[model samples]
Target chain A: MSRLAAVTGIGQTQYKSARKDVSMAGLVHEAAERAIQDAGIGWDDIDAVIIGKAPDMFEGVLMPELYLADALGACGKPMMRVHTAGSVGGSTAVVAASHVTSGSFDRILTVTFEKQSESNAMWALSIPRPFSMHLNAGAGGHFAPHIREYIRRSGAPAHAGPMVAVKDRKNALKNPLAHLQIPDISLEMVMESPMLWDPVRFLESCPSSDGACALVISNEKLASEGPNKPAWIRGMAMRSETMTCKGRDEVNPLAGSDCAKDVYAQAGIKDPRREVDMAEVYVPFSWYEPMWLENLGFADEGQGWKLTESGETEIGGSIPFNCSGGVLSSNPIGASGMIRFAEAARQVRGTAGEHQVDGAKMAIGHAYGASAQFFAMWAVSSEKP
Target chain B: MRDVAIVNYRQTVPVRDSGPVNELQMLEQVIQGVINDTGVALEDFDFVCSGSCDYLAGAAFAFVEGVEAVGPFPPIKESHVEMDGAWALYEAILKIRTGEADSALVYGFGKSSPGYLRSVMSLQLDPYYLTPLWLDSISAAALQAAQCLNSGTLTEADMAAVVARSRANAKSIAASQLKGDYSVAELLAEPTMVSPLRKHDCAPISDGASAMIVASPEKAKEWCSQPVMVRGIDHRIESSMPTLRDLTRSESTSIAGKAAGIAGVDVQFAELHAPFSHQEILLQRALELDDKVDLNPSGGALAANVMMAAGLDRIGHAASMIQAGRYTCGVAHATSGACLQQNLVAVLEAAQ
Candidate 1:
């Protein structure tokens, strides 16, 4: 028999271009302390600490968790650093929950961050590996061709990307911690923005930000004793495939579909669109919103764009998404995924102040990384399974 | 918790440099080699986890390229850690206990020769306080050695003897990076490379990869002729501040060892990830290993210090010994951060 796990508290730093005021330790500490305080517990309540980040090069610090141990109140406790690229945030939370499910620890503190301001992230990401392509564009450049293929395959309308960008920015107006809160966000403004990667406009892409996210996860026993209502973790799953494998579809990735299937199966959900009240999907690019919709089984293949055109993904719609502005409005790289997970929990707990989906019963949190090969996702609900 | 056992282990010969071979090529060889030893197909493993540092490769998402080694075509359940492979093993064990996976493939690799290992490791320190001072790893370790010496907790002879035994025991292993029949007195006579620590006192900078196959107890018995069961495993961390920790002793290791139930076990041999000579002594005392324990039978990291892979190598080496019937029970240790701020201890026993 496995022990149930729940998210008792969630915290995140204000996303920004540069967090110059705080060092890496201070940044993570800020989020961790908030989560502890929100949980109404002291640092001693945490049994272990798990941290995740995209890469050490982003902060020019190799395994910054070593330095962060003291700041996180992790001394004399077990600590592990996870690095599964952008999906690290989701995977790190999954690992923390698994520790509780394994009956090893009662309360676990999990955190993920990326201090992009510390170093030039574009340069760090574009470093030429031996025997690989040298004249490569950064992450956007690598994904542009794939976006073009997705457009070609789905035959999405020209206005779909602009429409999704405008929707997320509009939603950002409600999230005070969001990095990009454009007051006059509109489809016309997004279409007028310069195109950086052929079909993907500059406004459609996520901004580089420095931020951290933290969660206080506890076993069922401890969770029952917590001060606030808990978001019960229904299911969690992670999957990966090679960057270049035979017959792999980068547009509608198979790894992502498999991950969604596994997570939904674990949660005993047959129809995701009807069961999942809201979703906090990782939409780094505006176009990804529709593409992921089909991959996640929210809509049939070649029909996801219809949902976007109908505006059903907007707040107060049938299936609201990016209620917390999602990645397009604020991308802290590693913390982006955890922010989505946290948003899902917040909505379920009825604590999502401005952007709360009314009476959200179940929510989905998803993230992908590394040429869309790695996928991590989880399902959280207000009611225990 | 479910019973898990390691059934197969493999590692590349540690060398000063891997040249233009690259991380993917090195990892592929170990992955294929471990599969051959186990006689099990890659698709049979329920999960995969690897340990690597992208900083060593001078690129972000460098570990993503490592997926090519396993030919992840249909996709698989997997995870990666920006730490030593031993921690990856720890995660895999938890996956099995939680019934997430019945088996897992754990691997780690690093090429430290391309960059100055000491200066590169300096980046791992506290950036605001230590990195600004540009304190390299050797100097940091030398400070630890100086404190131990000044406190009368260790001596030059004790340090030299550790290196001498490592050299003598490692001479027969083909994967040994540095080995010879040297006397403790001769090692002591050599000029100190950094204060009280000599060149031999530190582990050599090596490039290598290691892999192991682990499965649940029932699956292990069905798949392998010999299996080494993971009896207990635990890890603990302390302050990153070198000044705050007791340099003369490893308090974190003691806490981890006790949590792993290292006490009252008939551990005949041990494999420790101690890159420095004094550290080996410090760890032995912390874990309460007496003279009966055969320390560093494979010369430990002193024989082949392959950064991210060495910690996993210690666990792999210990499991191999148990498989060979040379030892019925043993302990394997892995550590990270400055002066062993974090430590993982795993107690292994041969299947009866």
Candidate 2:
């Protein structure tokens, strides 16, 4: 209906449990600068800045974008701050894309970061609120019951958790900026790891990371004048619902399905299993790989496990997913969604070194937050929409 | 090119009392007033975005109730900004430009009556460097006022002039709080709230909300008799590090002004969000408006500084002037953080 916008550049930081080396501002700047460089442009070339993050509490700063303006080279330019729970990164990218597609700005710098190590995520998310019982159990703990339900419904074996943990840790080896690197990791190590949430072992869960993700989004005009081939944003969609609602299916969120449907319709994608080349779905917990696979309509209801069980989610498998280690190997919370989007772009560009999906022309990037009710996803491709 | 316009505008009056009603009640009425004024159903708006601070509500996701206020059954497509609703307007505009939605609803709310407004604003400063010093917001504005005075840009008399103009301007505005004419000499005689900034020099603490609905050119005509088209909209930011930025002038405002085509704007009236008297002069200079412009026609934030929503309210007032056939063209401004680190400037006009 309007001029298409595309991702012309992408960059990310080496996610880690603790980035003792750099401050939060410095961590974000590193990613932004690299993204600018990748786009073969300077800060002056950008028209606006749109930054997103999980929460202000994650870094103990209130609307940190105010302070980060100068650091982000946003001085005297329209800058915006977005927050939509954990899916903020994906939402942030879409906001930037809107500016481009709307013909408001020719070039925009979109970034998201979370230095979760600055404070404990479990404590940060569990900050007591009025009229609400403090469950104190982290998001994984909140989802553990749902995960159990999925396990019972699918009748998948318990060891399937370790299978994904080992596969993704191995995928992390390909991403130079990945946070966790268990070079000697094994399925045994994953199986033996302490079960923090039953069926969700400590090691099986994503590591808290201090990192950032950034992208330089531009419209067809800028893309046509780009230094590299553009990742055309075929379609983007975000749908959010109450975290506590009657008939809220934590196991299979309707929002996630609806969001996927909206984006697929725009992208003109009919059969994701056949039309889409690869995927980068948010998987903070290992089981989400299968859960989202089903929710996204890549498989029949409850048959997501079969796709993963048959190795279809691996790098070379049909409809390969999470080729950049996914969120299981790195969880920066705010930046995690953008990382998934960036990894999906990498595969399409044929730039993914260690985990390249051959001839990847189209792919999907997805993220969800807050009891899995909030969902943000995008369909991207090397070919222009 | 497609044009976007503000089809409707509404705000809750800022005063010293809200009695016993909670956020839910306040939002319910404000949202109803706005939706009815716009003549649009909740589902008619293809996009919805808002702005508010969680800390001000003394809880997390305080704006979540605001979404409920919209009665978003079937899940209306929406997003949020942690900044002022003025910025939310900017995001909503982006949606229009992208062709994702033909219309949008942008709103914001804040309640500062429960806490010390100045003391709570210190949270917006740098946690490591500024927070430990406990530099509240009003004092910071006062410091900038003192700097303006020292720079010989204006005197206490000039500061009093701004206060007099703002208060006098509010007299014609409906439900305006601080409206009346007083001489600059009289204002100087008033007691000071903070050094260099008298009680009259600073805006009153207010708790309220504002909502605006915007539509595409085709949809705009269907909704309103006269929609104030968005001619130009821009925002800019300076470093939050107070020590690194110039306190006397808003560098961010000047940048935003230029991007918003301020040079070409033939102004009639403006609704400026000047929390303090001196900052108004600073913003005017940054915007480079000569004697041709009628600035702050509604008394501005100086009359009732309601934090997040006040900025958007300034915008609403300016557009109302144009929509009511009172102004041929106009401008509105909104600011955030200490020392006016972030600034938004919007230009409104009657379509040719």
Candidate 3:
């Protein structure tokens, strides 16, 4: 009953520790303008705009979309703001797709960003609430325990985490816009890095960067006629659970699993390992690469680390993952998820210049947040369903 | 478009402060109330969405705590907006129209009592320009009222009449925080709190939460004997810079009203979310509504404005009136940003 939708354009600002060259509106405008240009459409063609960010506290602005309406050319148009924590970028894209798929609008421009330079994400995230103990130092401290639990349950080798860090960082060399471009990144270098969180080393964690990502989505008719090849959206889904609940499995969250199942079902994918040509998943920490591989059904419950250790996740391997360097290389918190989703679209559209997976016909994009209780995933293919 | 209707709606009484009852507890009560009233289990909802502001709670990821209200043990499909609950309902309508969901639970909450509500709202301005000025919300509205009065569009008595009518209507709404009968002459005699605006003209800072259950036509019939159909809904936004806009007129409201097909329907009664009484007058003229159309029958925002939830409350109140057979068709309006820069309009009608 739903109309088909596809991604006709994608744009991203260069990831950096601080985008001092541009203000918040200017940063977002850079990406939105690029996306609109890539889509070969004018501002008048867009029916609506949807923007997303991690939290207002990150930049000390409440409902920033209001102020940003002019910059994004959303004046006199339907504008919306979505917030689902770190997964907001992906969720924002899904909502934009809904604008087309629901037959409400023909074209929608979706944008997400985070200027962490404005404030400290660690302090914003770890603010002490009344009556609640503030034992967690930050996101790293909170997620480090879960990563350790995954190691204890999976029996992953000590080198597994370091290997992932090196692989992702090495991939960053091919991505010009990646925040971190360490040409000499190696397994030994990652292992020798300071141990920030016990099982997570300094090199294993993501960076706090300021950046923005944008996408232009349209219905089938306009998409087919667009100047560029469209990445047809096969399926999209979002799921969430309480942050902490009785018998919650933080390491292998059910919400992540259920989200993958729902998207795969809609995409008609029976075996994701075989059907999915590539993936760009949220791996803020190196350990999450394997944790999500298992949670997303790419490997058996306890065998996800084996896939990584086998070197099968490399670009020339069976299934290339995070070929764009992923969140580990460039994390703009709010835009991290959409960066994954955009990378997937690039692969399927044969537009990923240096990191393109050979003949990638189908790909998956995934992101999670809030103690791993929220999950958002989408499947895109070169061929229309 | 799918025939989505409001089957059940619930709200907690607006109060000056919730005290020990935190945001989660206030939202939980409303969510539970809607579920119990509609006899629909929590898991029955195909999707759940909520709207709230992090600044109101003065913390990051404050909405995460609201998830506990649904008891999401099984992990449900959900999304959230930083806008108002009316926008959450818009997302639900899109989901249902796409066949991704047949039923959705939408809610919004905010507690403005803990902080200086007026000063807290200034944070919504342009960070590089207006935010540095710390121009609070009240002063912003007062500026708009001055423009309206200077233009000779409306007098102080006209604004007072909106307050007088709102107070009289609040006598019927149990959730209303402020209610009293007063003539326009009596209201005009009161001291002006913000130059051109009186204290009664501004919406009371109240803490509350509201929830609504919307479903497809089939599910609506199965859930409730009386359902108010959402005829049409649309929202629009103008420039954020106050200097770029005409504060005397709500252009966005007029655009959204036309897009929502208000001209095609004979709206009998209406509920409008205008934090300030002068805004109600601007919105009425923007929507092109005549005096025949009843406005703010539930006292509107001036009586009990619950920040993020007040917009949805307008739609909920209008739907409730339709269900009660007070009128067959009505229009519900919600506004955001200073001087009604962003606006949403929804037309609700009883089942024909």
Candidate 4:
């Protein structure tokens, strides 16, 4: 194929339950401007703009890209809108990178945003079609049973869930843009919080937020001229499988494993645990940090919760994951996965402000969607692959 | 850019209420027919991409089951878009451009019969300002049509003529649900289903699927001697608010077509997925394809608009004409979201 692509700029918004100050288009523009600033160029330098978000139903704006183009300085450029469920953010980034990799565009701007406050996701997701069953349970209900299965399979301590919630929230305090910041959060606070779904307490669930993420991907020569040093895009891969069947492994999903394997292979790493310095995973619920940890092959199956209990996922740990608070602390649904990816690049670039893990060389970014059946992951490094 | 050309194209007979075959079955039959017509094995293709929506199937990731159509024993490099197959075709070409694959197979299918197609479609609008009100797709389009009529952007006579011409064209095609020749006065005699948009003015909820094969320039020469060359292609979107955009014309289509080299073509035929007759006029104005272009020779979406796939079929229909040696150059158009929120235009030519 082509040589490779690198990420020269990354930006994320101050995620919140409702960004009432800015409109949906405004939220995305804010992030795009930040990324442009970070890249040390005006919007005129951008060759093409690629955008994505979850379903059009989420924000009540069908193909919001149409409304967002001018705001993001994409008036005369070819802007491609992509929709691929939750991993849309990562998919959008890949599509932008593909244009660069295909020798079409030299520098591409990719952005994904979700203004969840614009509509009720619980109700929007439950728009009863003609023949489908109506369960207004939303995301928590859709994924809780799977958490129960992970608990049963792992046979981990009950405190593992609370432990993860406290740690990730505390990490959020270090991240100014993270959506949630619980002042007095602790293991006890998490344990005492009202359970929204069994095993998923109120403190554990991600807040529906209004936020956006943006990235500027460029060729090697172009990346060298960025405002801050760019993180070389080592590898990117995406995988999918049927959402349901006779035997679906929610805890150790095949799609997650397959996606990880492909991404790791592309990055030329046989042992992800040893080769990767850190990771930023899509964890809307606290428990998924461990579940996806195992699913991502960072640890053996059923032992991922042990990584959480051991405090290994926090900063300074051997494999520090979600140093930028992750989706658990700031989830704007469609933009969450891409935020993970941009955060990973930040860590590698040594530009992660307060949340930067020390001297991190290579980092992994992961995102999953649709009952954990779709997975997209990539590796970024201080050194080019 | 990768030199991807349309090598094979096929579609099922559009039916108002097709029986027995589910979405997957329809996809398989049409995709298999495409492969058979091409004289190529299904596994010979290096990549497969599909386009479809979950809302139409009453579930999520509706295109997953379509893998059975290709019989994926080899674990193909595949992807699906929650859009029309034309976009999927665009992505597949990108893959080929990146040197990731050679030839690719693409398809899209939807059965709107199971659901309140129009109501489900309303979910595509901005949920906060519009969907909470539960505005069905027909009423929304009807409102736009009424607004168009009131402003003298389109007349009732003009709308009727579009219906009459489409039905007249549909009679010659075997795979059409609504077909008949009628005068403008006869259509005006019918009662209104939605004000300003009679039943004849809107397209039926068609149950159909379509498939197309694309190969790089080298592979296309090996597969088909007379490949329909995709000369230029591009898509664009306008604003989301209905009032903000001009309902009478599609600025987005005009921008995309001009960007895609549509203005450079000596257009011989065209297929614009209007759905509503009035939309045809708007699309025509946007593409600037006047009397010189023979639009919707395949009866167009006015006869059968199968949501996501219908738009892709527009591109395929135009390209098929080029392959049949009927046109030197042609234009195809596909629209998405409400009132043509997004538009894709492809310029195709038959190389001499």
Candidate 5:
């Protein structure tokens, strides 16, 4: 008995290594103001605000929504802060959608941001623990071994990783807000980059960035009377598990598969490869593209690399991926997932100026975090459900 | 919102300093205790949501380890919030209202004794404008108390009376960290911890965890002996800047109270999350609770404040009163941010 919800406005701040020009409040306000303006409404129109971000250590500000309440126009309104590691951005949108679907609120503002320059994410992430050893490694170091394992099991060609890097960095040229823009990116240049983590080259890993993403969600009534073409939300889901339980599959997590299955069922999608026009998936490391493709049921186990190697994942291909350059090019950590979700909505609305996939009727957005144990996904369509 | 009820709730004794016990171990005790109290197996829950601050642990993604305590081997659907656990309950309630989940397990944990809590709380302020000045939590509350005192809205005796009553009521509750019987004059005579505020006027820095199981109406009837129904719940936040807000009043609490239908109805008892004694007065006035209502029956947070978990503890204590046949209906309030910048109000009732 859930009501219908739609995405009427999407806004994002320019991705950068350090947003030194503005404070944390200013950075989020930059995006939130744009979202409210794009929704063809004033700050008074929003009934609630839901914010998501990585750990509080990212900005040394605990429960940032408290400090950001006025900046995002959430004063005297129900404001929520979500944290699910990296997948929080996507989960935040799902939570916001639930408010509208449950007949709780009409228009809601959902925002996510991470100011990595405030403090060292690596130090915050790898602090010494009471019962555990000091890993002293960032996400790249932790994820590299999984990439090695994926290569060992799938026997995918070495070129698979480089190809993804070249495609996404080249795609960044079309996105003005993307952090990394390599107009002539090629496979050789990516392969020649220094090896930071064993299987993850320097160019294959995502950079530490400071940015924010904001979206305006509305119930059916307001969406129908909106000025812009709304991207109707068909379904959304979130799932999680222990980070490293016994007999856990890190490369292809069951939580991710379950999340995808639940969302597809709610969207009435039987065949994702044929039904989903394009996808914007979280891929901080280049190798994650194929790994997630298989885990998300787009390709069979041990065969997802073939999709990337055959040029089928590029724009105008059978099923395009990362058409807006995705997380590899512009990753603000906390906002990375929502950026993917926002890009999918932009595609369905035919508003993605340079990166829009032609005739994109439906699209999928996906994000994973916490050693691949937490996941969130959503589906949006041009036509109302 | 759909009809949801709190079937069971459990919490650890708030300790001034929880030695050697990590958050996971403390959470395991309550997670298992609440499930056992409700007679609901782990698999019976359709979703799990938790609240905790990583800054309290001084590590990033510290909550990720807590999922292990929930036994997420089968990969349960779940989410987490950075606010108090009361907000986690709000999300679970919405999930049931959406017909997406039937029942949920909500929990919150924090260990604030490891750090200088007064300074650690400063991190909740605006980073560029307020945090850099190192305005400790006590100083901020003192500012609000000064305003309330200057306006004659509150008196030193009123604040001491709150402390004396909290200490007396907390003695019967085993989970309370500080419990004693003292006169208002005796408390007022103590040396000031922060000018305009005495040591008894502030909550102790406690460490503990709390867990609650909420279910839809049908499920609640099948699972529990006495189910406490959640009538209406609403939460609102005010401007963060102290300069932009009226420090003497809680505008967010007043708004949330009305939205949760706290008007007209006879609210028999209350559990208010007031870490500072003066805040208790502001909340009482804001929610319009008169002398007839039994306030802070379990000592509220003044006896034991466990940071993130104390707010949810207030909700559970209020429902417990109704379930125990002491009151027919009650109001519970949880506040976050400095000087009660954010507030949540829930009205709980038991079937007559």
Candidate 6:
């Protein structure tokens, strides 16, 4: 049997367009130090370090973990770097938990970050390759067609996208570390925003930010001994498929659904909407909120937009989603997924300060990447399984 | 720990430049080869993992395209690492040990021929300090080699001997890129590319891919008649700053070798991934392998270094040697970063 693992501590840097105050190593070290402190442990307590980032081109550093090893206190310890496109953050956490669950290490310091300000993410992602079309501008252009398809299929109102944008930006008010904290954000404001891609406005898109997220994962024994409440990892799963396969569902990817099903099975949840108290799903575009809702089995197919229109995904709603502002508000690209995972852990730990979902016992974190072909999700709970 | 063994391994022949052939095509050949040789369907594996660097490919999410070769139409449990394929194998081991998967398929591919590999590797250095200085990989190794030579730890003759042995060994390996009989004296006579390091001292920039399937004991028995058991595996990293680390020795290798239980096993041979010739001598001492142990029978990385895939190739060669009844037990070592800042070691043994 696999050993139990839990998140004992979490840390996150303030998301911003640029962090001129710190270097790359300093940026990662800040999060790691805070996580180590949050766990009430010293550098010596960590058994290994696992880090993840989107691409080396983003920071112009190939395998930055090799250089940041000293900053993260990974010297003389096993260090691993994980990269699975945009889902890298969540995958890094899953890999770190494996270290504990595999009965290999006791305490692992896992971190994910993105310094998009260091390089233009759009340019880095849109590099022209041989024999490949260059028409798709950036993520916005690549995903805009999928959003249009979702609208065309679901017959959801055009207001559905604006509603999600407003709710998440408003939710950002409660998150001090959120990058874009427009205190007066509203649906009207989002609707009036300039259309960067047809059917997707500037306000509905995620920001390019510099930030890092860290988590201190420990085996069951060490978890119980930690100073803070542990968010027990009930289950975790990752799934991937080819980016462009004939007859693939881009709007509601099977990988996301399968990943959700696998995680829920491990967590022993028959009904996710009733069992999961809250979720922090990856929604770089506001429309993805509803798309992922159905993919995660929280809503019926073609009816996920109805949940947004009904305000059921708000902070006080039955199944609160993105209560920590989510990727829409504070996207550090690579760290966005881990932020979702860490936010879920924070809610279960009752440490989400202002955005805490009251009495949240079980929560799930989700992230997808690479044309929605990669999916990673994990279920966490205050109660141990 | 659960018993796991490498059931099958396949790799493309290393080439200086695989012109017109992309990474996906190279990977497909090896992945298909492994499947055909083992008679195992793709869906039979419980997990799939890969290792590659976007920097080497000069595009973001390059590994994503490599995934197409796997034809994951039904979606599959998969993950990836930015490290060497040896680390991918490490993750696969963890997955099996965690009881999450009974078997896994791991692969690594890199097309280093597309770019100026020497300068491209500088991007892996500290961006603020080292990269700005443009300290390419060969110069970095030369710095380490200079330190080794200055310390009298090993003479230039020792490095030449390693190059000679590697070249002679590559003659029998079909995938090897550099192969020809050459005496140590002839190699030493060649002009140095970088001071204290001859042109032959460096591993060539080769493009290639490798794939391997590992399974639990029960599955191993059902699949292969002589599965090479993976007795122990461990990897560790040291300080990344070249100045902070001892350039003359591979401390990380020593630590990982000890952790992998290398000392307890009567290792009959060893496959060491030493990109620089002098590194081979340093690693031999660090691993404490005497002359009795056969070293780099597949020419190691000196003959054909495929960047991310070379490390995994070492493990594959080690396991293959045991499977061929060439040796009952062996150790495989892989290194990464400058001056061997990180290292992985594994012990493979044939069924007793």
Q: Enumerate residue pairs that collide in model 5.
A: none
lDDT of 5 at A85: 93
Backbone clash total for model 3 is 0
CA lDDT of each prediction against the hidden true structure: 0.90, 0.84, 0.93, 0.82, 0.91, 0.93
The residue-by-residue lDDT of candidate 1 on A202-288, one tens digit each, is: 999999999999999999988888999999999999999888767999998899999999999988899999999999999999889
The digit string of per-residue lDDT tens for model 2 on B1-352 reads 4678988888887776565655656667777887888777888988888888877766545566566677654655788889999999998987887777899988888887877777778877877778778899888988888888888978999889999999998898875678898998898898888898899988888888888989987898898888888888889888888778888878889888888887787877777888889989898888878787888988899887777888899999988888878888988999998888899999888866
User: What range of 10 consecutive residues in model 4 chain B has the weakest lDDT sum?
Assistant: B59-68
Q: Estimate each model's TM-score.
A: 0.99, 0.95, 0.99, 0.87, 0.99, 0.99
Interface RMSD for all numbered candidates: 1.2, 1.8, 1.0, 3.7, 1.0, 0.9
- Candidate 3 docks at the CAPRI level of high
How well is each residue in B179-298 modelled by candidate 6, as lDDT tens digits? 999998898889999898899999998999999999998888888898999999989899878999888989889999999999899999999999999999989999999999999999
Give me the runs in candidate 6 sitting further than 4 Å from their true place: A133-135
Per-candidate DockQ versus the true complex?
0.80, 0.58, 0.84, 0.32, 0.85, 0.85
Instruction: Name the regions of candidate 3 deviating beyond 4 angstroms.
Output: A132-135
What are the per-residue Cα lDDT tens digits for candidate 1 across B1-352? Answer: 7888998988999899989887788898999998987788999999999998888887788888877789887989999999999999999998888887889999999988888889988988889889999899999999999999999998999999999999999986778988999998899899999998999999999998999999999899888989899999999999999989888999988988899888857989889999999999999999999999999899999889888889999999999988988899999999998888899999999987
Candidate 2 displacement at residue A182 in angstroms: 2.2
* Local accuracy of candidate 3 as per-residue lDDT tens digits, B1-352: 7778999998999999999888888998999999999887999999999999988988898888888888898899999999899999999999999998999999999998888999999999999999999999999999999999999989999999999999999999999999999999999999999989999999999999999999998999999999899999999999999999999999999999999999999989889999999999999999999989999999999999998999999999999988988899999998888889899999999987
State the displacement of the C-alpha of residue A160, model 5, in Å, after optimal TM-score superposition.
0.2
Considering only N, C-alpha and C atoms within 3 Å, which residue pairs clash in candidate 1?
A: none
Clashing pairs in 2: A15-A179, A102-B97, A102-B98
What TM-score does each model's chain B reach against the true chain B?
0.99, 0.97, 0.99, 0.97, 0.99, 0.99
Candidate 3 versus the native: TM-score? 0.99
Q: Write the per-residue lDDT of candidate 4 for residues B101-200, one digit (tens) a residue.
A: 7899999888888778888877766645776787887888898898889999989999999999999988877777899889999999999998988999
Summing lDDT over every window of 10 consecutive residues in candidate 5 chain B, give the lowest-scoring window. B261-270
Candidate 4's chain A scores what TM-score?
Answer: 0.97
